[model samples]
Target: MLLQRRALLGATAVLAAPSLARAQAPSWAARYPELVFAIIPSENASGVTERYGPFVNYLSRRLGTRVTLRIANDYAAVIEGQRAGNIHIASYGPSSFARALMTGAQITAFAIETNLDGTKGYYSVFYVKADSPYQRVEGLRGKNLGLVDPNSTSGNNVPRFALNKMGINPEQFFGRVVYTGSHENAVIALGQGTVDMAANWWNDEQESNLLRMERKGMVRAADFRIIFKSDQIVNSPVAYLNTLPDELKAAIRTAVLEVHRADEAAFNRIYEGKQGPLEAVDNAAYEPIIELNRFVDNLRRRG
Candidate 1:
């Protein structure tokens, strides 16, 4: 059944090719001086800004187009910016991307942070402390679980999807649940024993960061173990305003995707203090997320 679904999704991709082609074509128009990219505050504004400001500046100089990193205080603020068409591009987590596009935003590219040569998806990890007797999610059957947020792709949707597949319904699976608001908070909640298990998005880059922190005594990886992982979906994508001109959109895409190979330093800076370089991606890549949203929404309505 999974393979058949994949085939159907592939067919959808092919069927949508013409429309995508039309969207890709360039138009004759003056380029904008500044491209405002809204970033979700994954951490506190000060921490993220201190880490990422230099990267945006690097992008500004490299593209010869000013790139300003606008931090949204929360997810609602981010979505509002999309609705206003003031945001040019943004890196939205998979589920967040679905909500934004579903409500009326246009996604143009996805970020490729993984080292895999061709893959662009990430996992949703269910983590518990190392010493916890809980070995699997089933053990937490009636315990509190920490979810990153309702709109988080890997944080909420993936975990719910996995739970449902296992013949468990998340709404009733856990005794109680709470939203941590950020992945970092979810991790901390699990560490402090405030929650029996924490749900979050885990990628190679994130794993490495956690390990680095562990090594530095910030947190210990040995203290936590992954009990679950969900089917991969396209990583958070960079979305654009739906009303943007074709030419201007193409130029913006070209600048971000094409310029990376030639300027490594500038590209890496966008990752802030951690990773390096982002790969080019498109809207078609997020089909699974779109499908998931539709499926989940229907399930909710039926309930």
Candidate 2:
């Protein structure tokens, strides 16, 4: 009888363990039950899914909830998704994130990407065909320019800011301008000679949209030459809607900052270990981008 009682008691405790864990889940998690995480469209949707699959799975496990993955077709969609509270979490370029706030999207930036050297910035670069006679931005005047997306930071915003500083209005300078809709598409347009020049993001010689495309054999790095490189812009950031419960927000931020520590291989796959892990960040870090956006807005007004 004594042995049977002891065995029963042990079984009860074992069964209760799961209950305790469930109780620790965020108060709001009960209401949400599932969360939607959206990723900015830096690349194709299929590739985005393959790259983010493990990371999203890790987030689900860490948060003790079902986290669904959604790849945004454009930065505007991500911003709109968050604004409408349809997306619980989403990543954005610095300028895109800034645009969200400027346009009243009630979101908070929680984590920022970093360079391999631990710098929290990247650059906007102009790409032209290597054999093209044009060697400078001036030479490309009256030529078609490919901007990634209207909301893209390094893609359109920073590149335009750089041009405005050069006393050239993109609308009046370029024979024509087209938004290729993505970094990959910008290069695609350039490679196909659809556009004489394209603006894209570059972190370093080891990592860039060009290198990513090269790996897929879509374009040869040697075939393109970077004609202009803008000053380092703030790295992209992951953000959450402000409407979420504080506890949920904290958990999401903690989970993001510890992603590399929790699953180094998954995190490494995202950046190929060429970049550092995500770091804690907030709205203040993006003020410069907000200012930049404002400046760009003023330019539009002047134009």
Candidate 3:
């Protein structure tokens, strides 16, 4: 996704037609010369950096500042980083973002990721080995369950919510619940027989954690079957601190919104699949998820 500087620009002009030469440099940019951008490790650390490095470079050029990418070990680290005002910007799963705000992080969502279908939502699903005796959620009772992370939307929050909706309590229902630390690890655990089933995100047949692993030859898609899938959850978002100046927020928003148009290949590289244009969104978009987290939190409290 690297682009050489020349008469024709590739990702160099993601937000600026000429490296932000025309727009007035904001005071906030000078004060915060370098911005820390953290992301949850949906994949392994190196894989995450490889996937987002180009997009980070493009964002730096567009914002006329240095942007360092921090691949968090877990979702809580990202939420804490932003809460402490250390991470200037972050990419978050819906539930993690909601948790951040619920825990009193002063941030505002600027851009929402759109799926290839042009929808602003995805689903949480349960997966088991295709040959496993577990044919449904009921069959998985008394068997161990693998989850991505506690702060994860699809992997944690939504799965619990889905189970509770079905009158199932994860702790009592599953023989044991294990936190695999990531969607990748959850599926890996399933494949390795560390758990009977796992929870993850699925957006159509073409996009999912399973497909990504399958493409990398980590897991075969045919080896697993989805036993349950929750209702559509809000799409993930990229947000900035509320403390940032309005102009800086606008700059970040513009850069994100124009990413696909400014550099098709670079944008495509970030997703590694089909994607729709970015949508401008706000905190209101994730209120339901906050409630979902509240529900999950209460469940944890009772347990």
Candidate 4:
């Protein structure tokens, strides 16, 4: 009878082990009742909120926690917020994400956006007024230029790298360089004659900064002309703070990946796509930007 009892107890323990482990697992929902989601200010704050609010709400319902949307005023704000642990999750530009990682921020990129045809990249374009005499990047020499941000991949880093590769130094080549803070603002500055030429992003489907503004009647296509366009740069990333428990991390990843299926139209509108889906990405995917960052850093240090 003792031997039989011992065997039964061992079997019961084996059956209960998985459940015990699961029950002992840390619950982020319990510890973190509210999670802050920060987005890079690709556009104005109000515009960012209006576009990303529904997506945040969906994450809240899917993760079973209250998620607040934060439209950071600039790229650095989002990076600093994540570094300080105030922002739980962030949609980061590639260059900004590289900067965040280099700065020792505890975060991991989980997903990246795609174009309407499922391409996973976009371009940096240099533009001038439609009637401007600038026919090439060199033609814009000694003219005032507008850049989005130092941490912007398409708006700043790529353009700088491209010019450097072409044997041109942007700081010395342009008469004056202005950081417009946001892509839309950079375009607006060009329209308001604040800068003779501007650098911003251009999507594969032609649905990006300039297009968004045109849709809202802010600028017309004919208002600007693309003088230079850089090679494909990977789309932005959605990253979560690594401080979250493993279970919560998995939940957040699942929620984001499944969001498109939950509301395809809303997802498309948020991303300005018709049927593109988010795909898993990692640090390796951003190596190009990392290289570009190094080049830009060296260039700055030399100046």
In terms of lDDT, the poorest run of 10 residues in model 4 is 5-14
Scored by lDDT, model 1 comes in at: 0.65
Instruction: Note the Cα lDDT for every prediction shown.
Output: 0.65, 0.84, 0.84, 0.80
lDDT of 2 by residue, 263-303 (tens): 99779868877899899899999999999988988888898
lDDT tens readout by residue for model 4, 60-82? 66666677777766788778888
**Which residue pairs clash in candidate 2?**
none
Candidate 4, pairs of clashing residues: none
Clashes of 2: 0
What local lDDT score does residue 27 receive in model 2, on the 0 to 100 scale?
Answer: 78
lDDT score, candidate 3, position 25: 65
lDDT score for residue 283 of model 4: 80
lDDT of 3 at 255: 89
- List TM-scores for all candidates, in order: 0.79, 0.91, 0.91, 0.89
Error of 2 at 153 (Å): 0.6
